[model samples]
Target: MSDAPHSGVRFRGVIDLDEHKVHDRPTIYVYEAPVRAWHWTNALAITVLAVTGYFIGSPPPALAGEASAHFLFGYIRFIHFAAAYILAVGFLVRIYWGFVGNSHSRQIFYLPVWERTWWAGVVHEALWYLFLRKEPKKYVGHNPLAQTAMFFMFTLFTLFMIITGFALYSEGAGIDSWQAKLFGWVFNLFPNSMTVHTLHHYGMWVIIIFAMLHIYAAIREDIMSRQTMISTMISGERQFRDDRED
Candidate 1:
């Protein structure tokens, strides 16, 4: 019995010769193009809103002897409102996609109230990241945790923006304007619109924190799993292990 014959029988692929190359096999596309486009567009809009919002919320020390320089504040307000409109459009499109899009993008599947398996999914996902398990539970789209976060934050922030935005706009429209009347209930509850405005300003920090965490998680997954997690939000394709089909 020759050793050469035994070696030929035992050989697999490049992995059989190299231990370090023992990684998961690659899978096909995961995210779609629309989802990616929505992500980046929303990101840009949010960035603009944050920068302009800071100026709109608190004016800097006035430049000496330039009374007309107050237009800087006016421009900040204009950009903030403009970005808000763009963000609102992106938000509406995402909602519509959640209905007509693929199974992963479907609103019913992502909504916490509707997804029966979401609780288990959350636990499994957490364990997956914590390294408690060798193989992670797979989802074709947003994981349970992400689905819940996006839904809650998007809904609450949109309402907050609308209520506070309308309240502010109503000031210039006069108390009798329809805008004022429509938001009259919110103002009545708060009594001081400035307080509501302050809350709205503070809400940006919450969104920023969420964005930071989201980006970090995406990058971490990409590096660890060899998945194109971040690029999927731009190029709309995620490569995963072939065995990890969801």
Candidate 2:
């Protein structure tokens, strides 16, 4: 059986389920293949980067054995650097897909900051999250509130971390290296590599917090909102569990 009878119908703002008549929708192909791939790839990359980046920032107690025998910290740094590069490349590919893929792929890159309806969505979604509102707004992709957070917290900070990461790498990569040529300008802005490192570390926390909230919201929506959340990205189809609109 179909997820529900396919329908293009969507509500642009918050709706009270009690007020609207029922309309069933089984599934929609909201996320394209590239978008799905990028989502999971970025998730794994961020997880690895966070754990390894932590060790690189504050290493564990040193081994008692000869320094040459212990390369644990070195391995940690190596993993951090690898994940950083992976994130950076994935960011670029996601940007490219945002242009070539379907409209949903572009939601995170920008926000409808000036739209009055979008602002209303931000407030209503906030209320819904806090349990102050009885019903959450539903969208084909991200609801307005999620769009705002994804653009500012995840997308913008990802770019910030990428630049600062490469800038830090340029330090050891040598001033003549391509990394320096491409990212050395970051030094002109900060004038100190340590400052870049601190900002980069802070950026990591921003992503971490977003990831936590993203997970919480996904699970919450999957249950409370009567819709697919986690599996949408996995299967590339959003299966709505209710006949209610909005």
Candidate 3:
């Protein structure tokens, strides 16, 4: 029998029709191990960076003991730096994976604005989120609107953060250090370190907002959409509610 018209349910001709049973639909491996690894690692790094970066900007109450005995702010800076390095390395590895991984892997790097159909999909997804559409289209990878946000919002801002982050680091690394030589140009635009520091602080908040939205969207799609979302990242498998043609 043909798959049931409704999603997340399938037909199986059996002796008992009264009992409803949901059959497993078609599934495909989407995310690779490297992609999943980078996702979690990047998430952790962003978390640490955001939290400690905030404290670095506005430190907590001073400790009672001597400055030598209290390394509270120092330790916070250390964690922020460590997390920044992890984020930078993970970003590089993720870029490499995009080149070698499956076609779905590079979905976030750019848009398919040339294609009329892709634009159509983007509009459809936007309306779906706005409750203007009844259903969301199923895709093995990210939908068009999501790709746009991931590319423009997440990826672009991530690159910005790395650049500014390194430039700020070059301050401590000294003028002769490699970081200073490479990223010191960032200082050229804003000679005052405070200006860059303010921008960097705001960048952290932007990323934090993106993270919250990303998580909310993932969970929402996982529940409301036809395909798996959260589990797909963990297991690299995307299971559709129905075996409908895409």
Candidate 4:
């Protein structure tokens, strides 16, 4: 196929491009170490908070032994309080990391509301979830709907729970304490401390619902979308099934 004399190079050769099938590509480094650490740490803290917080709201049947000696209820409260503090501190550290870490680290913190393409992605994701779309798009970070849910359902609700929780703690710590100094303003909005307590309780349900969806989506997308999901958070690397750019 070449015009040049004595050249051994073949100008071209034809091959079926479709003959090759690729199941993976070079992995993208997405979540950083701090972000991944905070993710699992926050998950554990959330699980403990939800379970113990539920019991704090609804007590189990009394123990057979003397109530004076047993501290089962006290233990539950301690665990719940400890987990809440862990979650709050983790969230704060995550926020700081968002500013200093990789761009993917900040995906869950904000929405691109002004972008029409982002809106299209939201609709596309919604349709995919409903089984109306045949194929799902690949993303190194969260898809649009997941990002929205994270910002509203997880992030805001986590902040609400922290503030209200500390305000409730301020009652025992007294109005003069540091907890009150920081979160006492939350009382001004609710007026009744019990009202804040109830709202905080409801926030737990919202977080639980979001968590279920997050888990289901991760597992589903890992199988159906041909991209790594659950493992991405664990190893901070995102892999796609194809070389095609998103």
- Candidate maximizing lDDT: 3
**Candidate 1 residues 110-217, lDDT tens each?**
466656687888777788778886655555577776677766675566657767777777787789998799876777778888888888787787777767877887
Candidate 3 regions off by >4 Å? 1-22
Ranking by TM-score: 3, 4, 2, 1
User: Would you list the C-alpha lDDT of every candidate in the order shown?
Assistant: 0.69, 0.87, 0.90, 0.85
TM-score of each predicted structure versus truth: 0.77, 0.87, 0.91, 0.88
Candidate 4: regions farther than 4 A off: 1-24
Per-residue lDDT over 1-246 for candidate 3, one digit per residue giving the tens place of the 0 to 100 score: 335645555566766666565566789999999999999999999999999999999999878967888889889999999999999999999899889999988887878899999999999999999999988999889989889878877998999899999999999989999999989999899999899999998889889988988999999999999889999999999988877664
Q: Supply candidate 4's per-residue lDDT for 54.
A: 92
Give a tens-digit lDDT track for model 4, residues 128-228. 88999887777778888889989999888888889899999898889999999999999889899889889989999999998998898889888888578
lDDT score, candidate 1, position 227: 49
lDDT winner between 3 and 4, please give it: 3
Ranking by lDDT: 3, 2, 4, 1
**Model 2: residues >4 Å from true position, as ranges?**
1-24
Winner by TM-score? 3
Candidate 2 per-residue C-alpha lDDT over 1-246 given as tens digits, one digit per residue, 9 for 90 to 100? 123534555556755644554356669999999999999999999999999888888999878989988889888988888988888999999999999999999999999889998899999989998889887866779989889889999999999999889989989989999999999999999997889999999998999999999998888888887568888989899977755655
Model 1: how far residue 209 lies from native, Å: 0.9
CA shift at 190, candidate 4, in angstroms? 1.5
